[model samples]
Target: MDGDRRIAAEIIEAVGGKENIVSAAHCATRLRIMVKDKEQIDQSKVEHIEKVKGAFFNSGQYQVILGTGTVNKIYEEVIKLGVESSSKGEQTKEAAKSGSVFQRAIRSFGDVFVPIIPALVATGLFMGVRGLVMQEKILSLFGITPDHVPDNFILFTQVLTDTAFIFLPALVAWSTFRVFGGSPIIGLVLGLMLVSPSLPNAWEVAGGQAEVIKFFGFIPVVGYQGSVLPAFIAGIVGAKLEQQIRKRVPDTFDLIVTPFLTLLVMIFLALFIIGPIFHSVEEVMLHATVAVLEWPFGISGFIIGFLNQMIVITGVHHVFNLLEIQLLEKFGNNPYNAIVTCSVAAQGGAALAVGLKTKSKKLKALALPSSLSALLGITEPAIFGVNLRYFKPFVMGLIGGGVGGFFASIFGLKGTGMAITVIPGTLLYLNGQIVLYLLVNLIAIAVAFILTWLFGFHDKMLKNQE
Candidate 1:
């Protein structure tokens, strides 16, 4: 705890002291601070702080990357030090004003999806495990034929693997409500109503085994299992509507009346209106995405790979979680994840080259740790701390990533899930594709390392760091 306080104090001082801070908030991996005077900040000092993996200015905020759990602790400590803090939604709104319309949309999508990735990652791992155990060769090696496997065990695994996607609407709506400053519980209830068992199952309807019910003989409704966009759109509407209603209701009756009315209206809008409209939009998006990914000669994969880490640097890469989830839901696997993993590996490779070639002890220290971290599927340390600073290495990493992405797509390599990548990502390829997965990563790392070592860094750059 004392350590946290010291780090927080250091961070506060480094970012031009608490007096210069306009507002502070944190997301999953960063301490985002809006400062009254950017000129007062010493970026070098902040980057060198203990436990700070990297730091950069983006969208008018100085974002100090502290990875996942550590950022939350540092944020709490900052709050304790008399610095005024904004709610996530308020901070998001403030930050959104600095970006273009497209960038803001990406940031909003990140806000919604970042909170729910853990659930999707867990479900993906569960699916991998289920796949592993159900493999015919594995079953035979264990002397347990597929026919001999327990039905109850299969059912249990199915439940584990299916729950998150099956109830995706609730998760999306709940997170979206939180992002939009609404009552998360009310958002959850509205989302639950969208996928209630009482409604016809979306999959069953698609399979032509079930029919949608007509509400009052005019409004047709169906369950929203596996849907994403509708729940997100409904969450915004619900939150805004609830806020407006709160203004009119007396404080004494506000809590009770606001929730009841919000849910009543939101649920109606979600089921009969938002669900149908966005479901079609989602279908179009899904089709478009598939078409792009399946484009000839892996051109789409190369572009996505090259630019993926750039997206990460901007903190908008979390938006891809929605696409990954949608892909997994529709096709039961994610080729996008496989392609992106190569991009991640390329970043690590470039960072490793920097680490190996740099003569300055400080540059060596930063590059090595950041490279290892990137290899483990986290890239901010490598990108923000080492590669981006060097400029050439970052570009080399992108080129390497593009090359790797091309090969991955050419091979049609895919993981069983979304989220996890690089070394740990091997778990997702456990069902007979592990070897191919490893090969793709090796190709990415090798290409990136060779490129960066040859052209990306110089001793003069390290001297500058000194």
Candidate 2:
């Protein structure tokens, strides 16, 4: 542990010294850093740090993707550094810029969720496969559908897929408490309260019903199931309250009394204050989606272009899951879903174009398949494995995404109800959305390819040997 801290501290210094860091936090396997200037931060040096797997910047955060086993220690060290620096008045104005509302929002989402990417990857793959399985006659013969399938497999998959959402507050509370230097036990207690089964009906308090004897005559705490923001708020309050309790309590009973008091207060707030506030925010976003979709095309186009990328990185990008399910819920199939499909294809196209033009044989090999994979809506390979390494490809892909999103929005292309698949979905077999989906995808690919070819690759000379 000491050695790890020593190494982390050394690397922190080597990357333009501590003064260069505006703020630092970790998400899953990556360290989300904001620095005074990208120019001063030595990306190569940072990448070379012991246990550092790779380094890159995306959407303004300098991400140091660390390997497993060391993320928690590094995250803690980084947070302590942040806290201590602030205390000493060594903090710079650049830190303020790093903590902007937009940047903070992105960072919060990433930090809270990125650490759980492996489980998510598995869940996503499983869900995607399940969708395909239900559609396959051979698999259906084994009974996989709601009516036909064995109950056990369905229950198992449900548990796996729903675990994250059902217990999200618990996870958030734990992570936030760790970051804030509070007790994990207290966090767990607070988090569990938000998702507790009892809180949902607590909203009946607002109705002034008979036998409505509330705690002190009618104030009630609402449930926070499937909520993200409320858990965060509760965690923050819990941490602060824990600190206060720790300061007041004597050292002898510190461990026992501190957590007990902290948990009690946080549960109260989670049930009463934080949960309700977050629910309101979610409602706002849900309601706004419709109004925005109804707006003028040009305005909607720009917003879609901008917000789509934002949504993808946050992993909530799968909230589109609900929309896809909406097809099954209402119409038995979804239509008008071309936007995300095309957006994903744009990235793949951009990567593929650059992959072909790059002089490096190894890079080309990576880019080619990455783009192909991304066309099916898997951008991790394209974004991280390809674009992050090759600058021109990422730029072209961003351009392609913007262009494709704009045009698709203008044409009013709609998706046919189908589970998103990589290769099978590319054909546009069922509807005009699929056809236009292919067209928009092709347009993005062509534009990205042209841009990458003209811009020139960093390793242009290397591939000539092939």
Best lDDT goes to which candidate? 1
Deviation from native of the Cα of residue 299 in model 1, angstroms: 2.0
Give the per-residue lDDT digits (tens) of candidate 2, residues 1-466. Answer: 5867865785677567777876676554566666667787776566446656456665555676554446667766766654222321122123323555866554444444444444434444454455545454646677554466778878887776556656766777876676555787778777887767665532233344323324555564565545566776777778888999999999999979998888777776666666656657755654565466546664564456435644765534544543343332222232334555555666677777767766756566667766766766667657766565555566676666667666767776544333353344543223323456567667666776677677735564334422
In order, candidate lDDTs are 0.88, 0.59
Q: What is the lDDT of residue 268 in candidate 2?
A: 67
Give TM per candidate.
0.89, 0.59
Poorest 10 consecutive residues of model 1 by lDDT? 313-322
RMSD of 2: 9.2
**What is the Å distance of residue 255 in model 1 from its true position?**
4.1
Candidate 2 Cα misplacement greater than 4 A, ranges: 1-109, 117-121, 136-146, 151-153, 201-220, 290-345, 358-396, 403-443, 450-466
lDDT of 1: 0.88
